[model samples]
Target: MINFPDDIFSEPADVDPDTLANLGPLTRLAGVWEGRKGVDLNPKADGPEQRDYLERIEMQPIDPQANGPQLFYGLHYHVHIVASDEDTTFHDQVGYWLWEPATGLIMQTLAIPRGQVALASGRASPDGSGLLVRADRGGPGYGICSTDFLEWAFRTDSYELDLRFNADGGWSYVSTTMLQVRGRDEPFRHVDKNTLTKVAEPRPNPSARIAAGKATLAQAHGFTTIGGGAGKGD
Candidate 1:
């Protein structure tokens, strides 16, 4: 297993919105959003099952993070999803959406409460509508890991997700996950798709807004910028 050194990280700072300009393709996705009429398709013993669900997501910009010379701008996100019929949760996820301005690297780290974790990576242009990212089972840098039960029953070979922004400022994603089921000789392609529309605008990063508000009040009272930036980060 790979281990991260504690010395690698510096003091955490409050998130800054001005740094969002460097996020490239991930910049637009930083904010609160909702997707209605999400449809998911999965492999069932009998056949394919389809279900409609609703999702509420909040993606907030974080301040720039650095690993020595490597820098990343990203969003910290939380997603809660519910289905029309079932009282239990349809899906729940927490992850980070990171963008490397220097290398055009995009990374998504996802963790579900159901003992599953995966990391997906890909590249995208700033103005491009379609973005594709990939992650595999045994990669050193970009890979997926699972618990013993999932690894034994449904081994995930690779995952690919494509996202496109429509004309109306909405976004849609098509996710394909290749799984090796224990009983099936052939690989099963599990697919899911959904189009999310903007239900509300995103709020400014917490620290940025708070600092800005304080500055505004101070300015009204005949004050000036402190010695320098607050240096707060997400």
Candidate 2:
């Protein structure tokens, strides 16, 4: 038997407009980053193949999102990778890193061009320096999904990502993917790791920009008022 909220249609009241202020554990990820020492181990027909890659990632804040009473502040991100000698993209990914302030829940939604998507979930403290999130093949909430061709050729069993904020003000991640390839006797562990340094700062969210605009206008108006009053007094 399953139980759900009766007032599911009602959304949360007094939601915060500033996403960066409410991102909790995901706050450190909002920036443009680059990694040159990325390493990837993937399964091939013959055996495991190792490759080095250069990776760039950009994460920016979005407006507050709500699901009935549950609210989320998240960062929209894009990742692109290329080999050292190649100009073409080796891998590309887009995702959202979400943090729920009310529950201390961290979620990552990933979508690749290779017909696979996943939602991974975990828990973390607001000021924590590390996080680990996972999604299993048959989980009810955090689960993996793939196209039929991928399911038959290279079935994915699980996905996990471990993230850490370094003392040097950079971030690093290790991603492990469990795969059951066709005709393989054992599942293969596909792994990738990289430490990223910030290349650029992030832009403010839409709501924050609006707030700043309003503040600027108010300050201009006050200046004008004070100028006119001083002229009359003179």
Candidate 3:
């Protein structure tokens, strides 16, 4: 028995355009970041194997999104990783990090090229130093999904990610995925961790850019008179 809102299609009347200003906990993640020291541990047929890798991540602001009365400010992100000794790509991922200021809710939606997608949710303070989100195999809201091959060979049971903001403006994350591999008696915890340094700042969202452009044009045309200032002639 679930309740439904009759006005589900009605959007909010007053929506803010500045995503960066409204991002709350996700504000620190906006920028281009690079990490040279990344570690990955995964279960192999014989046993667990460790690998050192390099990682780059880019997070940029997106315009405010609305679902009825619900609004979200988010960052669209892409992550690329490569093994230290290899030239080929070790892993690639794309995701969105969303925050709802009204509810103190944070969500991460991730998609990997290997045919897996997940949505994880958590709660955080506006200025929290750390955050954690998790998703399970058979949850109603936040859950994990995978392709047929992955389901048959290495089934994922749960996913968890913990993020920490350092004092020096850098950030680090530890991600663990519980996998139930075929022929294995127990679940394996595949983990990855890295610390990233900001390389470039994020750009304004489209709505903010438009508003700034309008303000610039108004200033150039000496429209200050409209706000009680005298015109150039008087």
Best-matching candidate per lDDT: 3
Off by over 4 Å in 3: 1-6, 125-127, 214-234
**Tens-place lDDT digits, model 2, residues 1-234:** 635579887888877777888888788889999999999999998899999999999999998898987789999999999987789999999999999887778999999999999999987645687899999998998999999999998999999999999999898999999999999999999999999999898877766655666434333233335555422110
What is the lDDT, from 0 to 100, of the residue 212 in candidate 2?
Answer: 62
Q: What TM-score, computed on C-alpha atoms, does each candidate reach?
A: 0.80, 0.87, 0.88
lDDT of 3 by residue, 170-226 (tens): 999999999999999999999999999999999877677667664343343345566
Among residues 3 or more apart in sequence or in different chains, the pairs in candidate 2 whose N, CA or C atoms overlap within 3 Å are none
lDDT of 1 at 231: 37
lDDT of 1 by residue, 71-176 (tens): 7888889988888688789999999989876678899988888788889999884668867888999998888899999899989999998999788887889989
lDDT of each: 0.77, 0.87, 0.89
Q: Could you report the Cα RMSD, in angstroms, for every candidate shown?
A: 7.2, 7.7, 7.7
| TM-score of decoy 2 | 0.87
CA shift at 93, candidate 2, in angstroms? 0.4
Native-structure RMSD, model 2: 7.7
lDDT at position 228, candidate 2: 50
**lDDT at 68, model 1:** 58
